[model samples]
Target: MTPPPYMGRTFPETTSHYLTTGTDVLDSAGVEAALKAVTSKGYGPVAGAQLVLLCNEREADLISTWRRGLPSREATADEVAADANAVGPTAKYDFVLSASAPAYLTDETIVGRQAPSDFNGLPVFDSYGEAFVIKSELIPAGYVIAAATGGPNSEGNPIAIRQHPNAAYQGFREIPGAEQYPLINSYCQRSFGVGARHRGAAAVLQVTEDATYTAPTFAV
Candidate 1:
């Protein structure tokens, strides 16, 4: 048999990259503006509520950054509301305010534990998973639930009249104290609605929060 490529023989290792273009061409500032606005609007409703920072850095750090990022320009607020409108209630939020790698979660109002110096970066957890991390009462919750056949990847038709009760319950498993774990490849939590799964809601908050200077980042 042929030796594996590396130190002996070699075989081609390749992957394809994709191109994604928005409906309109936006400048760097425009892009930044949109991001700022949408995130700002999101906070408006949950201004004082505890938030989680689920990226690489501390959750508290992420929360601080989000609040500060909001008001630097007045347009940010509107931009946020606009994003909400565009996404509708059922989809995910547009950005990630937490640190990268291992998909860390930060409480919007609290500071997290110190990170180790020997931190291994989490690369696989990117946007697609990021898009799925949502807030509120998610149908099936935000997380993927085990299929009703009690099997993996067995998500059956949600609309069938005889759907399994667990189809929805098994779907959204919460990451308890999610703000502390290193960034996991996950979806963005944007609201309090439980979404399609349940006949009720989880904890849906309004779409706005108040802002003030948070520690770490200087006022923009």
Candidate 2:
């Protein structure tokens, strides 16, 4: 049975090595930009009113370094080495932002439909009917309820079918590893994805290896 090769390193042990490390190519700022780009695609009329960006530490560091300006060109080789080392392992940074917006909520807001109730009959307890309901009057004529169904590798879950851009999330699986017999034979792999859920709700700047310092275009 080979005794399971002495369990050189458990899955958790190997995966924890990169707890403080980050992707070499992408940075946090780039992540925010990517998200902005996705949302920039005009998901709907009232988009970007509420926005959020998520990223790993490496990505955040990349954005921070770019904000502070890269090391000077006139610095010594040692300085350059130190600066880059500080930057750590960066890969070919690349990302595209996408935006999606669901059909405009007729009234663009939710309203309470029920006052109060006491269904259980507890003297100290008071309950209410469905607290909120879509306003039939507010729904525009010819409005059709939008619902999503199937998706790749999904089970019995509601399909994401809002009338906005669907961020087909991509990139990075397990990090590739180097072979070493039975012990330490593989390394952890990580990647990132970016997207938005509303039209005109997000602003993104396209960033790639060719241009990291350029400003993000405001146009979706």
Candidate 3:
């Protein structure tokens, strides 16, 4: 069988907060609980450590300067700021996938929907970008990925960045509910399509940080 289509789009997800808001500091156990709650939501299979590295020890201005010079970090302050500078800008990539297959379907929503499933058949995709995130429900090290759709909402579709048919995807320029639909800007060749019309996968999941890092792609 061609496998019945899946429904809903909330991959299993886990988050951590580097923040502390209590008389007592957040310990390992308490932090773990917060993480579990987010993960349990089926947002994603995001795994990473969240540490309170005590940046309070440093001065405010120096914090930025020092952190900027640090060795290996995911995103730069400028990079994150720039991406959000202009709204409604699309991005480029090697490929994108949606991980919320049979992963997350809350009671009311799942009532008439198909169970979520993954290419691995295990359900849930874990491939998030740790770089672009400035803040997350995940702890300090908490970062993960969930395959998902990207494109105009009206089309009920996602655009694949790189690979096609299965890996690469293109857009039709008209996204239903978008404030403005962009004319077909061929960022790249279409290696993939959706439904019988395009003869491609009905869905394409995107890994926030999987592809080219030059341009950052944020997830839902």
Candidate 4:
């Protein structure tokens, strides 16, 4: 089923920093060091890894909110079988995990810390009879998302990323005439949107014993 419409817009930009240097400085080690720092942090309207992490945080929020609005229950064997058959017997649920979950699963004191064999060398754990993928970088610390997978088509996926058909309006594009010699210029832009595609395809579980759910925080 098509997901209900829940619309919003955001234009989050990264912090901007500038560097001033003479022509001699360009060839110096200080310039190299500065460039390395910028690459690690971010520069000019884009926060590099920070931006990606923020986007992932927002996406997780959307998925959690969307799932919470739907009915909650345990999946029956028949329903699981149907889901498997619906997509050529490859369908299954995925438990996307983040932060403390991974550490907890691997803790020596808690789970015997035997270092469970990796799933085909991937970062996935299948000890719970379902794939628990570690996504600490993308997901918040306390949440685990159980999502249905291997649906009939693109829309079968719980989340969708929509982009304009026109190439000019799709990915990051650099603005012209923003550069001058000796001093460098940097600019990039993109257009895209994300939303839920299938209803009843996912659920969110806050891994907590508290009376109410308290959102976790991460360092950007």
- By lDDT, who's the top model here? 4
**lDDT tens readout by residue for model 4, 1-220:** 2223222422224322222222211111222223332333222113211101111243334322222123222333655687853211111222233323344443323232222333223343222112223234566544544444442344455468889988787877876543464234655678889887643344444434343445567686
Model 2's number of clashes is 33
Best by TM-score: 4
Give the range of the ten consecutive residues with the poorest summed lDDT in model 3: 51-60
Candidate 1 weakest lDDT stretch, 10 residues: 198-207
Each prediction's number of clashing residue pairs: 59, 33, 44, 0
**lDDT by residue for model 3 over 32-116, one digit each (tens)?**
2333333333322232321111112111111122211232223335556887543221211111113352345434322222222
* lDDT-sorted candidate list, best first: 4, 2, 3, 1
lDDT of 2 at 73: 16
Candidate 3 displacement at residue 5 in angstroms:
20
> Residue 5 of candidate 3: its Cα lDDT?
26
Report RMSD for candidate 1.
23.2
Model 3 TM-score (2 dp): 0.17
Report the CA-based lDDT of candidate 1 relative to the real structure: 0.25
- Cα distance off (Å), candidate 4, residue 142: 2.7
Q: Is candidate 1 or candidate 4 better by lDDT?
A: 4
Whole-model lDDT per candidate:
0.25, 0.27, 0.25, 0.35
lDDT of 1 at 173: 52
Ranking by TM-score: 4, 2, 1, 3
| CA-only RMSD, every prediction | 23.2, 25.3, 21.2, 21.9
